[model samples]
Target chain A: MDIATVNALTYEDFVNVLGNVVEKCPLIAAAVWSGRPFLTLTALEAAIREFIDALPESGKEGVLRCHPDLAGRDLQSGTLTRESREEQAGAGMDALNSADASRMARLNQEYKERFGFPFVICARMNDKANILRQLSERCQNERAVERARGIEEVKKICRLRLEALVLTDAANKL
Target chain B: MDIATVNALTYEDFVNVLGNVVEKCPLIAAAVWSGRPFLTLTALEAAIREFIDALPESGKEGVLRCHPDLAGRDLQSGTLTRESREEQAGAGMDALNSADASRMARLNQEYKERFGFPFVICARMNDKANILRQLSERCQNERAVERARGIEEVKKICRLRLEALVLTDAANKL
Candidate 1:
């Protein structure tokens, strides 16, 4: 809907509308609820990003863990939120063949084993191959680097998903 | 890189090695390729009642369009395999929100419009949310009664790409 419409939502309504905007991180929306009457999508996104930016390291990891693995079990079992499902599919994670799927599953396992969290990438910016390749390449990085990279990817995901939640017509006026 | 070594691949090598098995499609892997050569995953998945059997028409829609929007700019951008970027991303169709990136752009537009060539479901299964949701919801149709349902989704996307040359892996496996 329009920003005007968004602006008119009650605090609870606003939270309900945007609670899933950032995959499993409703608190982001919850935290941003106090800063309502956002003039533009960017303003709203920035507020949420800022909250995430200031999050404690553990908190940040918690946010990271909130994301399901790319094409991981959640997609098949229907456990993922609507936003997460769309993001992974946009990246074409739904159509893998046997050989490629096995590799991704293994990569997901490895990335989790190494970093203690699932590999997180902005699937919108990537196709399945690229996501797999990056997951492979990133698995070699030091933990700190990968953590930072995951967050960066999360930022990209936020921007993409935020644009989704904010509606393009509303964004066009900006 | 050959099929023989697929099982022995380390997480890194595995990702680099079998990375493109499905290229644009991620579900084929999640559905078929499991940790123990795939049978275990699908069986265990079956036991959970998660196996995608005879997807509802909407579910079929998700399965069919699990491909990229053929002609998505990413193909021309040289970031993805030519076929996949198009089938998954659909470039020239600018209307889709970055969030809608999971659905093939032009194909999605066309499929919704025509219900034709673009909606071919590969018949494999996975539980990815976007795929399942699309599959479940899009499967609802009056198409069987009206042939028109099959043709609309394909026509909307002839220009951005009409390539029909890429060989399916089934041939490669053969």
Candidate 2:
């Protein structure tokens, strides 16, 4: 949790901690492992750069598969782990209300029908209103755009997860 | 380009035309109305829920903005037209090598020193190498977390121009 504590981790330790995150998301693992000679920070960064570049076509579907459908009242029951659900739900259920919940469910169905996947986004940081607005607006995007957007969203989610996982010291060093 | 033509644009057009990707330094923006949305569709998506619940800290920043540092690299020079040299440089420099370029210089320094924007991700259906690599490695971020992840990146850039000025459909819809 502390920067000093995280910084103290050996490169192997660092990799081990990150391994959990990578395992949960293959795109992330691919990005981390892509390219060779992890000699310097810059080189490591280059590997990341390469991964980001390649994500759209190659990694989009893989990342999408990691997400779960966002429907039903039991927000806790979806693909999100308990921690993720708690973090995302926060005090928003009351805010979601009945109409919002129904809309989310309907949109969820339409989204799946069109794109063959649940509507996924990084809800950890957003509030109820913004999430609702985005869901309604994004539903309007053509199936293609929304599909591609879905992959990008997954990458952003991973980026956030990565950010949270990074030690404060390593973060500062960067 | 006509709306129909633009709307018909495939993944490439979506990124090149709608997303306004840069030719060099995929992350750098030459001017206003250039560069990708800060939050990927997926990231924005997740944030949408949080936004609905509480309006995440940077939800406002997710709007969009013009790059100040990209002023000098304008393709046409002097004129600051919507389609001017500066603007073109910001939007069209996606392919430029990041190794040695003033844009990258300003982007890296200003982005890191200012608020730690680890270069936004757009995945405009182009070469996935750069984006994939960035996504993987950027996971190890802290400061870059807020600026680089989710809708924050888009919000930072959106301030430069109004929605009406860039996205025709969004403008009309709004």
Candidate 3:
């Protein structure tokens, strides 16, 4: 959508746009949409602040659920939108060979067995090797510890995505 | 302190233990202290989740402020406890050579100039060199973009610290 069109949206329309994704992850949806109209980029940030503040406690789990698994090869093909899949895996996958892929799969299984969820890490800055190293090390954490760490990683991912969205919207306007 | 001792704390005492640290970063304080009488480690986790959910919109900046500058070594000494310093920087001043020091200073200045605030990264998982590399690369981001990224990093750090605290408290009980 055009920046003007997005900017022209009423608060309800804005909220509705976000609400479409809210069920996929309500806390993030709320965090992305909960505040007043964002006139400037700064105001948009302030809106984000308001939304994060008002998010419900239960919403954190939803945020956690939105992340793709750490192993680039393991995520369900259709689970993430095309952009998200590219963002999470494209760079790292280029560097991974067959051995790395197998190791990642094994680690993924071990991590899920230990934590009851897929291993998640913010892939924006990490390369394939670094991610594999992290996965192997993190799998050693106790269930409780790993769970806490996983949630934190999810929060990081959401914040990055939010920023990207805002920036993209701003660039489109310019 | 023992879990019992922590449990015995009045709200005031709990606040005191956290000290001015929380006051300087109220969102983090809220996240740390929420859902009190934390019995199991999981209970503490629940409290942090509640705190993150309950955070005020105005508190986002405060939370972001709590992070030490990514390349500002002086702030690092003050921002992290001694143990954290060793873990993040690998042996403190002894570990910092002249080349490393200059790189950090340059990166620090460049980052602040570009982003308005000090550069912020969750250093828990990175060593000095890696952090310096990240600082150098991220300093290239435009102000609005980097500000958003910095806030995201701060959120990650806060999440990690909260988990560490809960795990430490749980270990104390055993």
Clash totals for all candidate models: 48, 74, 0
lDDT of each: 0.53, 0.42, 0.52
RMSD of each: 16.1, 17.5, 20.5
- Could you tell me the lDDT of residue A66 within candidate 3? 38
Compose the digit string of candidate 1's lDDT tens values, residues B7-51: 443333332222233332222222222332323322322321222
Q: Chain B, candidate 2: TM?
A: 0.26
Q: Whose TM-score is higher: candidate 1's or candidate 2's?
A: 1
The order by descending TM-score is 1, 3, 2
Give a tens-digit lDDT track for model 3, residues A95-174: 46789878887887777556545677767767777888898999898865765676666555555655555545533322
lDDT-sorted candidate list, best first = 1, 3, 2
Residues A85-160, candidate 2, lDDT per residue (tens digit)? 6546673743466887788778776765665444667666567777767777887788668767776665456555
Cα lDDT of model 3 by residue, B11-113, tens digit: 3344334422321332233235434567864555455445543555333333343344443543344655543454455524335678987877787776655
- In DockQ, how does model 1 score against the reference complex? 0.02
- Residue pairs clashing, model 3: none
Model 1 bad stretches (over 4 Å)? A168-174, B1-174
Angstrom error of the Cα, residue B153, model 1: value is 54
Chain A TM-score for each candidate, in the given order? 0.91, 0.66, 0.68
Regions of model 3 farther than 4 Å from truth: A1-8, A11-23, A30-32, A38-59, A72-78, A169-174, B1-174
